[model samples]
Target: MLREYYKFLGNRLIDWSQTIAIQAGDRYVLNFENDDQVRQFMSVLSEFNGIHNFYLMTERSGPNALAFDIDPDSHMQLVVVSTVEVTPDYLVNLRNRIGQQQGVWENTALLFVSNKVLDSINSGAKDIGRQGGPFNTGALKRNVQATVDKSEKLSKDDKDVLKFMVKTIYDGEQELTLMDFADVYGIIEKGELSDSDYIQMGYFQDQDLATYSSKEERLAENHADYVNISLAHGFGDVRSRITKIVDGEKLISDLSGNNWQSVNYKQILAGKERLKQNKKISLVYDAEIMQGINEDMLIWDHPKGTSKAGQRTRYIIVFNDKHQNKLTVKFPFDATVQDKWITQSKINHKHYTVGTHKNQLVVDFSDLKTNEPESVKVRYRHHDIGSLGFTFNILILPFTDNKILGLRPYYRVKVKGEKKANLEIPSDMDELILGSGIQSNKLNVDKTSQLDNLMLGPNDQLKADLSQLSLDDDNESFTVTLGSVPLNFNVFDNDDNKIQPRVL
Candidate 1:
């Protein structure tokens, strides 16, 4: 079973051996060193029909050793080199192969390193735990804290000045974070701070003599000054956008008519609304508008036996300047559209001017000081006749030249009468790379592919490339029909399976 499970995994599988000393009821460890033997040893665990009588556990024994155990009440352990990199691809394949067991198995453990450590490994930061250099701010702060805490009794003002002086030192021309205090506390508890590191500390201490001030006064002054700096740095606009979203002053446009089943349509719309309201959700600001459906193009087939009722699917596109409204953006011509009116809710009384210019949708909200975030909905009938299968393209465009991260695309389809529709996203489509500065492959979902987080520039364009849909034929007419559920902004929380914001 193990061999077959890994048959498609290819070169990632290594070589191994089973210990000869096996006792009664004792599981053996399949020790791996090379490629061929590991392949042969894995064959011992194969059960062929995707059914396994046993399960596996992964362990990180050392910096170089990785191992897996198949304690099936009938089997053994498979140990491999610790030196192999624990890559994102490796983690994904391992999860898929483990096959979730029946009920919770407490003994089974999943071992992996944090992304920071993985990044360090990739960047060749091999010194492990060296300090005192420009990069070791944690160590520097610890030294400074020790010097301040052990010094002869000083005035409250002097201590505050010392602390601030140390902060400015380790912060190195950048903004200081809360962790500076936390790390100092950690070092103090561990007794890692000492007098030798106090030489430079004394210099900063002497410098503090001229700057001594009460903490309250310094914080108050800094707070007021930083507010202005933040505004100059774009926080003002962000605050405005967030205020609108939180107050629900924004408009939520929805359309429902034509062949769409009411229940399914409502459910899909509800999901989108939830996503939009999710507080943790992060949106790509300055999204580049792309060519969507060309006006009233024909898409989707009608129910087999019904008359040709045209397609009038709804489309809702949301825009938000995550940087808080510091950025202003005009509606992409593709979204500034005029078509059938369904419903528009100016819930918060947020005024908007919408119209069409030169055959494209045109919307203006600049007068309101809102730009980064915008949501538009338009419903229109497609001119094409119905068909069994359909193909469409999903375009991704970024509006700014800055490196944009975490841009993913998701889609949901609903049928009027059917509770669940069979949908498939083919693997043949071109691949997309997400941001995060890593080349991890995008996740493959229920038939569709994840719009993997992408790093795009103002002029860059990434396409879901193509979407091929095959809907289940309606039993009544034996015809396959397709419907669109405007892309909802909601994401599901993995822990409770409840709808929640996509936490960044």
Candidate 2:
């Protein structure tokens, strides 16, 4: 009875056998004596994981050979007889080759699929759905007919198969079967396909299956790798043009030809960021200093008076005999000297005109009477009027002699009711006397005169008799009398002249 049942089951399996072809390299004949065979075949399908394994299995088993397994529950029953057609090893190699080529085939496949869909819609194929079963023969036929009706560029047969393939593999509208891919291979072998068509079909299948709204946008995204590789290789003209655009040397409209459409969007965006950083660095190094004296040395005309705290005093000596004293004052770029004049009325001043020598201001002081003291205030303005400004004061003294006195020493003293005052003496005079009047204590007539202390008020007057005080050639000493009680006052020489004055 069991033998008879096995025979019956084998007959049923042969009757139920069917040839299935889903894609180019995947074709198999599935036979099942019963439902048990189908279950057994599905259980081991995962073991055939790669095309290499599938190829080896097909080669070992002849075209009509049946692969069977025993059912454990019913040890006598033949489980399965599955036969797959021989898939060429070259197909596996071709898949690997396409993968190595990266996005080349994927982009081509996309273009071909897009073209077919467009052609189908243009031919008034209204019933063609966007998605359907993996092997929708009706949709495939409509796509093929649409291409044929729209253009006569390709043969009807070639258009039919290529359109079917691109839709199956790229658009995922249908399953890509081994037989269909094999048909592609046959078409390629006959050289029936165009160069562009073969190039598109030869590339690897893209798993993403992403879609784009426009052809230009698709090209920019898909062909970015190709464009970059081309630029890297030797497309100097395109690279130069792109570089010019990135550097702001050229505009987008100046890209020339359709090269702009092919440019990688990511690279352009990155280039713009680099340009922004470069501009920031450029501003740091090349920024303008707003037309004024920004440096303290330039403003004060001395390295010592660089502090911004208070005004400084500068002394100028001019000879009485109409000898011109040229003072060269340096200022920042674009600064103008507005007006300079002496404040004293008794001195005869020259009508001075400010002149520039090597971008420095030159002021001349002349035509002044001897022993007539004057104060000159120079008012200058910068290019930017909104910025803060400073005032500089000059004490001008006219002397009778033309000898180079070499910077005479002056003593700064604080007087009553006056903040500060300077007392300057002749360099040749070694002895100085101070009193209410010149007493008769002279060894020689002209050298025995008394020198007034020039006190600011009677409250702080010095009533002491003639007292000789010696000062070093390079050092300063001070004497102060507060109602006949003399106190030591603070003084400074040229080395430490920046010390602030203390109250007496």
Candidate 3:
């Protein structure tokens, strides 16, 4: 029988979160590392829509294969890569060959859980605690508390100084953030307190500070300033995370090992994120470069109709093979050659202006000078604001010559002049939810020991035996294990099954 839930990792139905959509002419592809993994891939074959064809490949075909993920139509046939840590050199060469050939297939990409065929990917970061990096509950608790103790303790005077210092920075949007507060505390601890102390409402009571504002204005301003900085850093964003600490326990996630925390909160606005990218240009490629991208990458601007994220420069690198190698190619490319690149996003809710910061993207020519290139054309993807992957409506630029070209995206964060995010780091980061970064109230979990298992019937009231459970830091929580009990046939099912077997 098929189980209602499968628990390999993240979710049994990992693909359920997204729809399996294929356009009328789209072709889909599935690739694997080995025979076992290939079988695993086939096990979930029932998940996709309109899967008409499947095949296995051992050699190279054409150019666009490397540039894009060998997708034919909007659909694809699975391509398997049984290799590990295929270097940028390999990826680049593959791209150059496939990229040189234009319009052979629709679009395509290589898919693998990890370079190892496991979820580890091709790097140093370990996912499961069994492999590397501590992921167990004990490790997590120590890390959390340590990060907290390492944080700065603010003094009354330090708080006032930091608040004033930050107000000068995000003056347009309000700065006086916790970071500014931390900075002041650091300075004070370092014994550099030539500046006056920050006493919250107490600092401005003196005649010297009063010259800046009246008592009424000072109080109102301080409250407003405090409210502003607290909201942006993901403070009490979720109600479930907020609770009264009576003996330090939360209403949820209190089953076993646990920790609870709160973050700084401030006023907020509702909106989505957008990416700043290079301009669209009418150009052509070797038609092989499309292999790297299977999904159509759409460039998006903000809904507010302005982007402050990218202006700095970074190269729109095109690899010649599976490993990244700059391709030597010439074509009418429509990418921006600006020197600026996106570093980080803005903190304020207001729309960021373009050209306020410098960011850049440029392709290196040295790699292209090599004999092998990944593909003929280069491809890039970014942001939900502009383009959708697979739309393919934009003009395709061709790459026939060999020379590295640089493309740049605009960024909102200022470098060498202003700072970002220092103020927004949460005071209680340990409580953040994985993936969503949502803060949750700390839960305590312990092994249930009672053998008198009792399955609570619908509308059943739960009475606790404090003797069987261990006392937790959170007084509200107690752990108990219950056993199944014999049910009398006289009991009725919710379905009103009287004569039916009650064992079910």
Query: Candidates' lDDT values, in order?
Result: 0.30, 0.32, 0.26
Candidate 3 lands at a TM-score of: 0.17
TM-score of model number 1: 0.18
TM-score of each model, paired residue for residue: 0.18, 0.21, 0.17
Worst 10 residues of 1 by lDDT: 475-484
Please state the error at residue 129 of candidate 3 in Å: 58
Instruction: Please give, for residues 49-143, the per-residue lDDT of candidate 2 as tens digits.
Output: 22012111223443222222222232211112222222444324323432343332221100000112223112322211134422234444344
lDDT for 74 in candidate 1 is 43
The lDDT ranking, best first, is: 2, 1, 3
RMSD of each candidate relative to the true structure: 30.1, 26.6, 41.8
Candidate 1 residues 131-223, lDDT tens each?
A: 422223355445665655764554445455456645655655564432333333332333333322222232211222235345545433333
Alpha carbon lDDT of residue 56, candidate 3? 23
Off by over 4 Å in 3: 1-215, 231-361, 369-504
In model 2, where do residues sit more than 4 Å from their true spots?
A: 1-315, 318-358, 384-390, 400-504
Q: 211 in model 1: Cα distance from truth in Å?
A: 99
Candidate 2's displacement at residue 105, Å, is: 94
